[model samples]
Target: MNKQIIDHLFEFWEQIGKHGNFLTKENGFSFAKPTNGSWPNKVFDLTMEKLDIHALCEEIISEELPNSIAVPENEAIKDLLRSKGLRATSKIKAMTLDTTNIFFGNIDASEFIKVGSPTEAELFAQVATESFGYPVDPSTIGALVDKPGFQIFLGNHENAFPSCGMVYLDQNGVSGIHMIGTKAGYRGLGLGKKMTQFLVNQSIENQSKEVYLVASQAGERIYTKMGFTTHGVLESYSLSLH
Candidate 1:
């Protein structure tokens, strides 16, 4: 795994912090959007080095933030989290794609549209929540798209929004695909793949040299088939207040 890519992934989270409150310390950074019902309202890019886990956990608990952390998967961190009564919630694959070798399946390009305005952002968020079985605030989505180097693409089938994906391009030419999803009813139509390809294409056009994403279990197969290979794992832990 390239350390540069890993660092950029963290930087991507920092970029996300721009739309809301952000706090950075020696060990890590925390983000929160109290008005936005999104998952990023928690700490990320955590490193246990030179830090006090107990104090950090207490601070998070006292602040009433989501007791969530994303860090590299390892026994030491796991044990530390366990000591704090945090349990693993998910193990995400860190996958990268060779944007130059990306494959685009046979899908109508006309069905895909670039999300640019608040209305389109709302539609994209709605489709993403429906596809991924999660809740996302349209205002957050809209604010995100308004940032530089962020692009959202949506798939419109039969004049209805069914799938969506996003790409982040940083100044360092690092790109990442985030929140790709297709509605359950429209799964077999390959809209997810199409939306992914569209984002990849956008990344390449933006002069991004490398593109990556944290893949969910269901998305691992889709990304692998599209020429992405797993480079590392990110473990998510949720600390129990009790």
Candidate 2:
């Protein structure tokens, strides 16, 4: 349970909700919902007690918004999700890279541009959606622009954004790389790898001593070759409410 990456995720949700959205933590239940009714209407922090899982599930089923719960690899939690007709839509691993004695060769970062404007954030969101097949709202991207301890980047492709990634430095000096993606037309070009390394390089430059990421199965292989080792696994039980 030494995983700070999961904690960072909750913080990530909290930050997103603070910007023209909603975030609430009370009565052993934490909620984050976006105004656009897009992805990541979450009920996380399962360690909290007194949470009426049944009632919550019933509410979600009754609503018309998409919802997902961050379920850990616990049989009890899985059983509860199954009882509510929830399905495992995705699984991710928390991988870590010790920055000590790491190599940072000459990095040509001329193609990477840090997101600074609302327009750029929109393009970043578009690339992310194409890369992951999930619609990432530009509002969320816009909120994080210029936010402290968080940095977003896009791969400049002849004045277009074909790839993108983000890095967040937590209070513990652990930087997390998130949402690394390349547009569909831009795949098979090693852009993912380059985007990842660029984010890592940026994290190291930010003076972080460690780096971690929540990686899907497809991304796990890419990080493994980069010397990242799995520290924990997270299962997300999704409900297609809409």
CA-only RMSD, every prediction: 2.5, 2.2
TM-score quality measure for candidate 2: 0.90
Per-residue lDDT of model 1, residues 2-47, tens digit only = 4555666677767766664443544544545345347455566666
**Candidate 1 TM-score over all chains jointly:** 0.87
**Number of clashing pairs per prediction, in order:** 0, 0
Error of 1 at 176 (Å): 0.8
Q: How accurate is candidate 1 locally (lDDT)?
A: 0.74
- Residue pairs with clashing backbones, model 2: none
Instruction: Give the number of the best model, judged by TM-score.
Output: 2
Worst 10 residues of 2 by lDDT: 64-73
Task: Return the lDDT, model 1, position 107.
Answer: 51
Number of residue pairs clashing in candidate 2, backbone atoms closer than 3 angstroms, sequence gap of 3 or more or interchain: 0
Estimate candidate 2's alpha-carbon lDDT, on a 0 to 1 scale. 0.79
Candidate 1 positional error at 218, Å: 2.8
- What digit string (tens of lDDT, one per residue) describes model 2 on residues 1-242? 43477887777677766664577765656777775665457777775357676777776787632377786667787887787778898788988888787755755799899999999989888888888887788888898899888899998767777999999887677788888888888789888888888888998898887887888887888899998888788877876566
